[model samples]
Target: MNKVPMTVAGEAALRAELEQLKKVDRPRISKAIAEAREHGDLKENAEYHAARDQQSFAEGRVMDIESKLAEAQVIDVTKIPPTGRVIFGTTVDLINVETEEAVRYRIVGEDEAEVKSNRISVTSPIARALIGKEEGDTVIVRAPGGDVEFEIDQVQHI
Candidate 1:
């Protein structure tokens, strides 16, 4: 199995979610299933069918999380010596070359990518363009809107 790259924080978050699924979600679904089964008439019980469906979804999610954790390569940014260059889990500050607007993004794994949190997946176009780039380097990225240029202003490990 190919290893999936993940930051320490990302791995922790996934583990936490897996724990919640196994401890809380799994038990809740199982209880619901038992309660529905107790209602009798399994052939025509809508509640039983619904509980079963929920159980399927919860179990699937738990399996997926476990698989990812098993194959993950956790990288702790704090332990990595800073190189002043962008890499996986590095937060980069950039200025739009054309508009001169400042923006920041932390390169992370695909599973942890969240625009709302300013996290971009390492495989994403923007992160690909930023990787290995040092401060003051200019890179052109193919964004969903169009091609955009950004000048690296800063790179931080945290």
Candidate 2:
């Protein structure tokens, strides 16, 4: 499999989630299953089945996180030399050329992309158009709403 691009913060978040699932959720579910088994007649026991389902989901997530961590290429953008270009993990400020609306976005890996926080995936339309671009560069993004024009105002490697 190809190496998965992940930021240092993203890797830390995944590790934290894996720890919680293994250390807390795993034991809690095990205890619940045991208590449910004591009640007998598991064939009709809703609690037992519920606990089992939760266990399956949790275990699957743990495996997924482990696999991602194993294949992750954690990038520390701060350690990179500043070149004033829009690269992975760079926070970019842009303005809509037509509407003059200002917006900010950080280019991140697929796993860490959160639109609500303005973190866009590297493969996203705007990010793709902005990649390798520098301040004052114009970008045309083919968005779902239609083609939109933007101007790069600044790039910060935070």
Tens digits of per-residue lDDT for model 1 on 13-98?
99999999999988998999899999999999999999899989988999999999999999988899999999999999999999
Clashes of 1: 0
Worst 10 residues of 2 by lDDT: 1-10
TM-score of each: 0.97, 0.98
Q: Which candidate leads the pack in lDDT?
A: 2
* Candidate 1 positional error at 120, Å: 0.4
The local distance difference test score of model 2 is 0.96
- Cα lDDT tens digits for candidate 2, 75-129: 9999999898999999999999999999999999999999999999998999999
Off by over 4 Å in 1: none
What C-alpha root-mean-square deviation, in Å, does candidate 2 show against the real structure?
0.7
How well does candidate 2 score on lDDT at residue 134?
Answer: 98
